[model samples]
Target chain A: MAHVSIPSYWKTLPQRYCLIGMKCKNCGTINFPAREICISCKQKSEFEPKKLSGRGKIYSYTVIAAGSAPPEFSEQEKLAGSFPVAIVELEEGLRICAQITDYEEEDLKIEAEVEAVFRKIYEEDKVIRYGLKFRPVKKRKSLP
Target chain B: MTLQKVAIIGVGQTRFGNIIDKKAEELFAEAFLEAVNDVDKGIDISEIQEVYIGNSGVGGGQLGNFSSLMTDYVGLTGASALRIENACASSGFAMRAAILAVSSGVCDVALAGGEEKMNDTPRNRVRYWLGISGDMEWERLSGMTFAGVFALMAIRHMHEYGTKREHLAMVSVKNHKNGASNPKAHLQRETTLERALASPMIAYPLTLFDCCPISDGASAVIVCKADLAKKYTDTPVYVAGHGGSTDRLSVFQRDDVTSINSSVVAAKRAYKMASVKPEDIDVAEVHDCFTIAEIIAYEDLGFCPKGKGGKLLEEGQTEIGGKIPVNPSGGLKSKGHPVGATGTGQIYEIVNQLRGSVEKKNRQVSGAEIGLTHNTGGSGGTTVVHILKR
Candidate 1:
């Protein structure tokens, strides 16, 4: 895998942010990156962008051994030898595909709990890039 | 009831194999000529008033306009021609447009066709061509390819509906068996479920066998007013119903990859407008670009309840004798996918079923009077569903 690239905004954000979006006030549907027009209802609406809850269930996942790598992981061979990618069903109802950072590709199961965390994927120069890939959410000290 | 009707008086297709000798225009012209000639009762090319060409991979032309290059070769020039592209569903949408124009009384006769020549282009280039269909800003940026997208969908279906990995192999086994009976299919050899299951995986749960092959071919269908169909052929197929809707182009934007509601929306409209039920269709050629796609299609088209598609496979309901035969033309699976030409190609097969002219044997459903074609653009983002009747 190769050729995955990211923008400066996500790379340089002060806090780890999972890229998420909200539906327009005028239209009751959601969109990514927030747009003025609702794609479904076709209304020129505005969405209030919001950070994701960072937790979701694994909708689907795969262990892709082939295909081009994203630009951040130009050294993808080190990452690609074995990796997990999942289509996480965010609690908000939108399904998002992201890399699973904390597990082996074989460990993935359908509907497993998961959460997002910003990981410094690579550093080409002074810019240490980050991506909003996911990790299976372990139970946080239940009943504490 | 004077509901508008459109008849495909002519049809054509390039030989189903890789070719390097000619450009796309040459292929398009050749297929168009064959289609024009397929008009048995006799037709003149000059009478073709408009042209709608489907091509997703024709590149470097001064204009992205595909019809400009082929109308002259097909012996029809200066006719109002427009290109129709909806990814792999390009030709299907082209057929819908042609049907609409004739049914709307705008055109007496229309030439609808699609072609793609992609042998010489490297695999990576083909990947790039298809990559534009998904979310280029996010999914594509993450290096996800078409197979990757469908792979994701397959995984999601498994998670949500308990779709088994073996069920994916069932699709390949069925399509290959059907393909074995299709003379023009890219791979006309039957493969067992075990063989399909054991094939190398392109993406997890989806093997090389789970995917359709890249094809270099062209197809054409001539549409005319329904009343005029009797003048050309005794058994003219009617476009009983059609529905098309667009979903979010980006995979990430879709509510759920496995739950493609766009398909249900389009299919619902087509079924309602036609006053026909899914169970009434005798055969169907779904866009099985990947095996999982066909699974979702069964659910989306209302052939079965949502989440029951996998059980449909296990029960053999989609097989020829079980319930309603699906992808009997081998579908995009073994039939090969030429992107722009796939939609028309599926229609070609369905029409043959209605007309009783399928050259290959063993795969044909007995007495198939009604058929359906489902074509999509960029995952499930855009879908066009057509119901054809004899």
Candidate 2:
């Protein structure tokens, strides 16, 4: 397990919970987890916080087997035999990796629509860490 | 200041596998002594002016001041020594440092090596050590292992390029076959394509055989100014070019997860410095931490066109007798990846191959004049490429 200090986790809550990214003023590139400089233009440009739509499609995914989860997620792995994790390309054009929640294996496919949802990431003895996870978007049915 | 040319006169490595009897320093000493003896005219350890040791401190044993400890254990305590850490590419960067030290006229002779005793740690704790290499904030927190990260790449390659599982299996089979001929390899037995395909799944699309074993070993190399290389050995493998680069640590952050951009950038720099194209490479030893990594390497290193790595393997172009033999020392897949030591380990193999000194005739690439090594750190975050020639 990796040690995530309380202060560090607290500092990142905004980006973790609200998907706050840094929009580059020079190149108009949005850097997730935010950055001081623009990644695309490599400029020391001013940046503003941008909230994402929390919607995206799967770019890639993998089913991590039980017991193979990092020491931090051992508890969750025990409850879930095998779970899918994916890299989602958001509608805003930035990418983030997160676990896919509330889905079957068949639902985990490339380009499958998903939306971020608040969920518990992991728990230590003293505190619980909550963040966003992606799940398949429910399809709407047509009415007569 | 004008930079001097550099050459590797000698190289050595311990047989990579579980060996509980020896400590990490002891293994490093063994490799160092072998390297000293490998020098054709013989070398005096006291003549070494500097040393750079690579280690990830996986077991937390001697994490601090590790390079000094390794030098002290080997009886070269007074040399300028430091540890270089870059996850799996630790020693690869160490070698680069040594090359710079000698080429810049900072030292006449320098030693570059790496060591790791991975098997000593408990299995669960080992996971913690490895997990920290990736993005702990997102990837690890989301329950991603090193294998899981590569598996994701494997699946994406399959989806985009129509790479079959068999292409991945072929890499394992070929490396195992080469390793069987190498006495020092960790896994020295070959398996059928059927057996490789049937291996239990560690992560979806990545089976047990797709992964390299946790290994314990050390490797060392002796480098000197090219002008003085003749004093140490008659057949010196010149370090023609070296390059390194880094990218976003997290895989998802990159524009394309299918290929490691660091490798591509590093390889391009190396080729430019060497004044040679990819076609000039007679042989190569690439970072094959996972089967998919090797496929990506073929494309990244310019062995073939992008999205055609699997096809290149299927055509047997990378075999020993083929166009460009790769991993003749069995590679990380079968030779064993002891993390930090892996980089110099590849250097050891290439130096030997270029000198036509490989003990096993079967695994030797005949008439190999130029060789290359590609070592990556933490997926695609850091990469080092070196080109060597006789």
Candidate 3:
């Protein structure tokens, strides 16, 4: 794998580390991965940098099986037999795709509440890429 | 202003499979020659005014300027030539460009073709190369392969519409059954439902059989002004209407991942221009790059209601003798998707079926006067729909 230059990975650190997205002042739309323009109202409106709650539900999910895994993930796949990736719908009404980590295969399900956590996404060219991955939120038990 | 009408005078394609030894340019020239020969009255190579070649992988294959390379090999170097790259829909857009070139009077005759040699790369390397079309940073960097992207969509479809793995398997069984008679298909052997379902899973819901094979092939078509079409062929397939649309590159950004919006828009435009509704289409060749894609296409193209594509498949309505026979060429499933060549390859099947030239009569849709070809790039980034009629 080729080395991703410092600026390439560094610039997206905000979105990767904090789940920061642009909130449209005019239409109150939350654009994930932070776009300049809002898709909802088509207005060239001012934006507010909003830090997402990092809590969301699994909108969709897929577990990549062995033998057909992508080459880049070969290393990660070796550690975790099959990995699940999901599209998480954030509390702010914006959807973002992220790898579902820190959970077992049985724990993953559609609409399961999940919270973002910092995790190592991949290691390439001696540089370890870190990003947010969603894990199923633990259910609280009531005292009987 | 009204665009002048255009018609497909001739069409040809290489047998869809892994041509390990053949180069891209050679395959292109072979298909070009076949197209030129297929013209009923025969067309002079020099008279072809414009050339559009859809090539996506020739850069990896080492022949970068594939358009000029093919033009030179086919003895049409002087004719204006360019390459179109929209991933899998390259040739579909190339065909659109050629049709526009002829219809707009920019050129009386134009040649549209596509070629790709994907099998030359190692299997592991092929996965890396195929992933380039998607959002590399977010999707690929996160370790999602191409099939994984479709798997995401399939998962949503299943969650939303109750589309089962069995429904997906039925798609493969039907396509493979159709493919068995197609001599040029990559896997010409029919597979049973048991075999399709038992195939190992690549992604949770999509099994090995749900995806198309990486193939190496080429396809070419000769198009001319509709008014002058008769001079070349008595039974020319008219380019009744064509439409193309684009959507957000990343599937997550879209409002609905279950449906490809671009196809819905493109199909509406094509249907409007053709002055026909979806029911009028007697035959179709849809982009079945993945089984789920075919299901979504049925809904997007107005073949069935939204969330009901799975039911449509279960009813066997998409079969050869059913209501609207889709992917009569076995689609990209068994026909083999040679990325660049797939678009024009779809056109080749539609043209042959419309002309009553399909060698295997059983594969041909009887009394088929109208046909449609739906080609998509990436998941839903670009979609081009064409309506053709005899």
Candidate 4:
């Protein structure tokens, strides 16, 4: 069995280890973290599940000193040192926000290209919290 | 029908910083005295018909009945008073209330004031209350704070258009440099671009320096109807246009982060109502709760092109001599943001600019005939734009 698990509630585990967004079938607007209604067209019940293109550009990022971040993120980072926070521009024109893992905070450059990776942020008493975070593209390690 | 011309006959404020020991009423009286004193002649409290004040929940204090208390301190024996609040845009709304009251013939003279005694409360609680106006279900659950929301918008601005941190830092450097000149500003110390960028991060892409300090202070402005204006002062600043609008609470709801539509709409309404454009204005005091907000205001207020705000800051285009000098009174970024008092503070700055008394030598824009103020409530949900002419 894989160490990773998506509980019975999900329709399917994310594909390509990617974060999911919804596109308004009515207005063709893609939204991250999903929304039930379309703000532009004022149409609801028209959204369809959509997979996002993980490749994106860095908008802006900053390193928060450990104590300043939300109490939850601060504790989880005790296990993962110096997470990279970024706003990424998807190929589809949607801006997806996520934290970056597997890269040095100082090494990350603004507008640099990157892809997504689904990872566990923090797990509590008995429940596990799973979410998507981004990392810089490895120049030598080609995308699968 | 055109709105009745409203004029600011007097403006005043108390020292802005960490004010905790004082009560709201005491602060209001202090600011009220300053404004009445600035009237050139004198304003009797009895002559002032009404009062509008803004105060965000300080220590969860109930201020619904706070206005009536103001009359006692100001010695307005029988004046009708009311508290007006719209989140951080409280004082801005207070100014609007006073303007409308006089324009509607309800009163010839009115007082608008704002105060926040916030140092007595904890920072976390302040953050909690600040988040009250938005769609808390989605935003708070998602951990999107006011700074986080603006920070995300800053990130989006960078991604879609290439706005740089160095450019954003210019807002802090400029405002702080301006704030340093105003003895009344909360953070009267100048900040360099390097120091601003190196400050500890609050939200991603937003350094502590980029964010305005949590300040405690008060501000007041006395407005009079057109016919009775001469009774107050010879040089009165007329209110040409007043407009307000609201945007979707969620940042996701807005089409573009590069431009603030609410600010645009409010400014549009104000300009059309005033028969003026951004070009005709001499100076402005736009909301700069964060450096990014100021950058966006440059575009939203029509001072510069979209994606050109950062460039404008770098070239000193927003200084006293440029296309339009903004935040000459240090703005929210440097002057201090006492949430409720912030909006009225902008009015104070604009009136001072129109009067040519905005203390700083380098910041004094000479021969200024028109000035404007842009105030936003809770993460752009509500915004008011006012144009004042001398």
Candidate 5:
């Protein structure tokens, strides 16, 4: 498969890096990745651009075990050593899939609280590509 | 206009496995020749009016246009032919097209088939092409492979419905048992649940046994007008009803990952058109690319209520002699899934079961009058359902 060009990669920067989504004015349905039309109600209503809270619970998750990774993810798989990936439900009730990082193995359970953070996805042609990844939210400790 | 009724007169399939000697076209020729020979009264090469070949176009860059190349190789030259690509459900939609083509009075006889040669290519290339089925920019680019996509589904279904890993293993055990009886099956040996659970994990909760093998094979079916079907065979399988539906490409976008909406929509239309309820189906072949997929299919196809698929499998309901036997031809898991060829292969199995031609009596559903097949595209994006009556 051919790699996407710089222009194409830059086009979806809002969705790729920031947690931006489209909320339909007509039905209040949040469309992730910000689509032109609302999926629910089938109305060509005005879509309100909303920056998500980037907070959600893991709806489901999987660990990309070694030897079965795709060619593109070989580097990440090598560096991460079987990292956890998740499909998360945002505070707005919209679902998005992203890799989970900066977490221990025990935190990879279902419904684990996570928050989005921008990180390096990969690099090609001497250009470093970045994208959002979810990390387990830290539990608060009482001050002494 | 209402769809025309179609009947299947002949069906053929090559052994589903890694065949180093054959190419896609040769595999297709093998299945086509056998299908032509299977017709009760014998069908001439000239009788085939149109050909609908389903291929993921996995290697079309190297092999060129598959339909044209395959048709030319099989002496189908000058027959209006085109390739249909809907990821894994390619041939299932091709079956629907052939049914409509005959039902609408366009052609008297048509051939619907599919072929895939995934094994001959390098493993990396095969994986790359398989990833093409998902949203390339979002899913694949983000490091979510096909296995990872389904793993996510399995995780959610388990959480929401209390489905256990043992319930998932039961599907593999049952399918492999059925596939062991099928001589043409790729993996012709039954595996124990203990073995399945202990297999190497490809994706969490989905082990090697849970995934269908990558295979190279072909399948073909000869279908014609329902009324004229008797001219070709004494016991023809009528394609009573057909339906197709589509959903979002990526699984994350869908509200629910536990159930496939396309399968639900397609099954409803097929049931209504066939005038038979889910209980009426005596046998079925469903897309079980992954064990989790088969479990979800049981619910989506209405064999059991939502969230009850795991329990149904636990009760041994999907076994060969159980209520509404599924994937008797070993399914995509034990039988091989050559992507494009899978749907037609399912149709072939149903046609054989309905005609009482399956040599293995143990795997056969006795006195089966109504049968159904459900074929799905990548991650439930597209689904095609067909109902057949003996």
Candidate 6:
């Protein structure tokens, strides 16, 4: 029932699942989801597929109320209520937008350290779409 | 060979709100007729050699070949017609096309207008239609709506510039107050700062009152060669300048999220063409789809320094009685945003403001000779700026 087709979803899997980025060989700039041309250098130079480290911090965020959830996300909203979405600034210096998962409202702050985790994005046409979502980094307890 | 100059001989717009009684054709006809009647000298509809209609086909009703349908409805069936689609800036680009058609000597007279019927669509479908304007694969898939996108900007802006929540509410208060005087406004009632701040949150940092409502409306304007403008109307508003630009579609792709680079580039081109600075503009109709948008427009249009937009509003500088009167027609915030119709609707307001013909005396900017209209498609991905002078 999603607008995206099966092949379209499949095409995005590498970038979606692994946070694969395209680094412009000419200018040393990285583009999220990969691009043939570098945005910074405006060159059609060769691009190398680079895996982005999942560690990042929140740049900006918003809590989508239940009423404003898009139809495609209705099922998710019904199950989870309002959810927080954020622009996560990766350690590689590229900013990517994704839903922030497994965090309390008070904990969602700008510059909050987060790490990408694979999770279910949504299900449509009887196929579940899985992608990366950022969550607050959990601190490990000391072994006493 | 010198290119011809373009002038707007007439402009018209229906009361912007829910009008289920009339279909799209009827709405376009009504605005078209009003524009024709507004011309100082009579003009035959058949003389219109070219027509450019702006429409997003939001409801998916009569999407294909819509330009011909509108012209045929208005009895200009045989004339050349085309539809321009740039999301909310459709009509602004349509007007730009009409100016080019007249200025290039391709046609002596042309029609540019836009119409949309958004109120009748189902809520879920409405969300779907509006969502596609943004990056569907990434932004929408992450549950970002138009409001959510802007909300993100607002949060970042506040973080960097110390803009208070009150600064955002003030936009709604000022625009709603102005809309109260205009008869055509959809939300004609005014709201206080307290109420705007307290309104339910659609997206954080942006309450319900920050967003423009979905409405059904249409608007039209007639453009002709400036040399031949005297034959049609003595008060013809000259199309002093026009500029348009496009940026990266997704917000994440841009280097700066606080400002819209397209608006800045478009406004610069327009100012250069007109040989006029922002201070020369007596009145303006900038895209105020949300409060933060208008604030960003102020900076992008050079009305104030970057990050000073919030202070500009807080100082009452953009009010009707202030140094630069903006959105005196209530803007999209109060006047209503019917998608495709919004761009030309801004033009309609500026034309009337330039002519000193605004129905409400209090809403009129005094001695308004030069005016500007800033129309943006989607979240500033595309923008068109036009300068008008009497």
Ten contiguous residues with the weakest lDDT in model 6 chain A: A1-10
DockQ by candidate, in order: 0.40, 0.84, 0.70, 0.18, 0.76, 0.78
Report how far off residue A96 is in candidate 1 (Å): 2.9
Candidate 2: RMSD to truth: 1.2
Candidate 2 vs candidate 5: which has greater DockQ? 2
Give the Cα-based TM-score of candidate 1 against the true structure. Answer: 0.89
Collision pairs in model 4: none
Kindly list the per-residue Cα lDDT of model 2 for residues B257-281, writing each as its tens digit: 8999999999999999999999999
Instruction: Find the candidate with the highest lDDT and give its number.
Output: 2
Model 5 C-alpha RMSD vs. true structure (Å) is 1.4
Ten contiguous residues minimizing lDDT sum, candidate 6 chain B = B247-256
What's the lDDT for all of these models? Answer: 0.78, 0.92, 0.89, 0.78, 0.89, 0.91
Show where candidate 2 strays beyond 4 Å.
A142-144
Q: What tens digits encode model 6's per-residue C-alpha lDDT throughout B1-390? A: 677999999999999998889999999999999999999898998889999989988869999999989998899999999999999999999999999998999999999999999988988899888978877788888888889998888988899888778999999999999999989999999999999999999888899999999989999999999999999998999999999999888887677889999999999999999999999999999999999999999999999998999999988999999999999999999999989988889999999999999999999998999999999999888999999999
Query: What tens digits encode model 1's per-residue C-alpha lDDT throughout A1-144?
Result: 223344534542422355657677776666655556776677887677666687888776666555433333446636566456677777877667677877754458877888888776556556655667788776568685
Q: Candidate 6: which stretches are off by over 4 Å?
A: none
Please give, for every candidate in the order listed, the TM-score of chain B alone compared with the true chain B: 0.96, 0.99, 0.98, 0.96, 0.98, 0.99
Q: After TM-score superposition, what is the CA distance of residue A73 in candidate 2 from its true location, in Å?
A: 0.9
Q: Provide backbone clash counts, one per model.
A: 11, 0, 0, 0, 1, 0
Better of 4 and 6 by lDDT: 6
TM-score of the first chain alone, every candidate: 0.72, 0.93, 0.89, 0.75, 0.91, 0.94
Position A20, candidate 6: lDDT: 88
Write model 1 residue lDDT over B1-390, tens digit each, in one string. Answer: 254678888888876557788778887877787787778888877778878887886333424556777786666887889888788878888998998888888878998888887676776566566667666655654546677788888877887788987899999898888888877888888998888888876667788888888788889999899889888877678888899888877766676677676688889998987899999988999989999999999999989988999899999988867788898888889888888888888888888887777776567677888899999887877899999988
TM-score of each: 0.89, 0.98, 0.97, 0.82, 0.97, 0.98
Note the residue pairs that clash in candidate 5. B4-B103
Lowest lDDT sum, 10 consecutive residues, model 3 chain B, at: B57-66
TM-score of 2: 0.98
